[model samples]
Target: MATYNKRGYKPKTQKEKEEVVETDSATAEVFSSLDEGANKTEEWVSENQNIILIVVGVLVAIALGSWAYQVFRVEPRAEEALVESAQANEYYLQAVNATGEQQDSLYNMALEDSNGKYGLIKIAENYSGTPSGNIANYQAGMAYLNLGGANYQNAIDYLTAYDGDGSILEAYAAGGIGDALVQVDQKADAVSYYLKAADIQSNEFTTPKYLLKAAQAALDTGDNSTAVSSLERIEEEYPDAPEASTAKVLLAQAQIAD
Candidate 1:
């Protein structure tokens, strides 16, 4: 029969006072549990910090040993592989300039061993952790692309594996993957990569170009709204970029279509 928020109401009897004390006792139990847990945590940390430091020191020493091994042992092996790969690199450069059977021979030489030197695959295999190995991946992927045998998926695989950080070349690499995906009839996936490339920090050379391609792909897929949005972003965010002049025009056309 009591209404809510009847603040002036009183308990019917004196024993009702104990009911408030019971609620207060429950709250105190919660606070006690929290204090108990905090003390346990502090004690555990105090007891184990020395052991933790020793473990960390041992881990640091092991990591240093691994680095030393790489510097002394692995790097020398990679250097040897680089020397062994020189003939293959030369043949690849030659293949770039050749045609007919001469080109075929150079291509073959680039892929196969000659005079005890390693082919591209061998250099990649032996020096996989080295910078030269990563470059070999690019070189090999390009060679495969030039040869009529490369599938677009293979191009994407190599391009996505690019580990270069914070450079316009990485953006270009991402765009290359997008292009390869487009070549394989995967325009939707290509658009994602193109957008990713466009989102990276860039200047007049790459950012707007990739964004335009992404917007065009969006339009082809009946995503006119998204296409317009991307074009508008290009016009707004990159007014000085080469594609921006065209982007402004394209954005106007998209709005007309809308």
Candidate 2:
């Protein structure tokens, strides 16, 4: 007969004891797998310590090299460029303010200094990556344009080299190139550049002026549709501009042609 234990449950037989041992074995096997994974992770970390150190060392060297370059090289060059640019700007101002032959003389001086240390062309060539260098490009273009006739291609080249954004100078540079193209009898290209200038900064001052110029250029090229489009933009978006009246007249002519 089987013996009854507490709660009226019968005592375990030999088969029941074997079942209990099997369940305990399964639980132990799960824990053993977990322990094996942890041990493998620790072994991998210990084996790759030298490789990890080398990677960290390389990263530190790169950061320090960048810091050193900025402190020792870039800052000094920028300061030198600033000093030279101030002198060039003085010549530029004199040339712009003076009249006739005096203006031509000063513009020539600004392009090529006797000492060769300070001038628009010199600064632009010497410090090509600096802000002053970029401004020099714009200045050189203006000086050449002001000189007139002989330097029109030079004006276009330097104006095209200007890469600054969202500034009055940038808009002026594009417009200057457009003006040069007109002088060269490139009416279609002139229209494209004028539109580019108008859209680059899109302000009340420069935008309306260039848009009007674009309309005129397009009309010259027999592009009535483009003329109408640019004129419409000026009338709608910049009604207060001085060119708005001219734009209205051009728009009327363009519509008739279209």
lDDT of each: 0.76, 0.88
Q: Report the number of the highest-TM-score candidate.
A: 2
* lDDT (10s digit) by residue, model 1, range 211-252: 998888777776778779889878878877888877787777
Question: Candidate 2, residue 63: CA error in Å?
Answer: 1.9
Error of 2 at 177 (Å): 1.3
Model 2 scores worst on lDDT over the 10 consecutive residues at 1-10
TM-score of each: 0.64, 0.81
lDDT of 2 by residue, 1-258 (tens): 223323555447877556656756988999999999999988998999899899999999999999998898888888899987887788889999999999999998888865656789988888887888888999999999889887989999998888867787889999999998998899899998899899888899999999999999999999999999999999999999999999999899999998
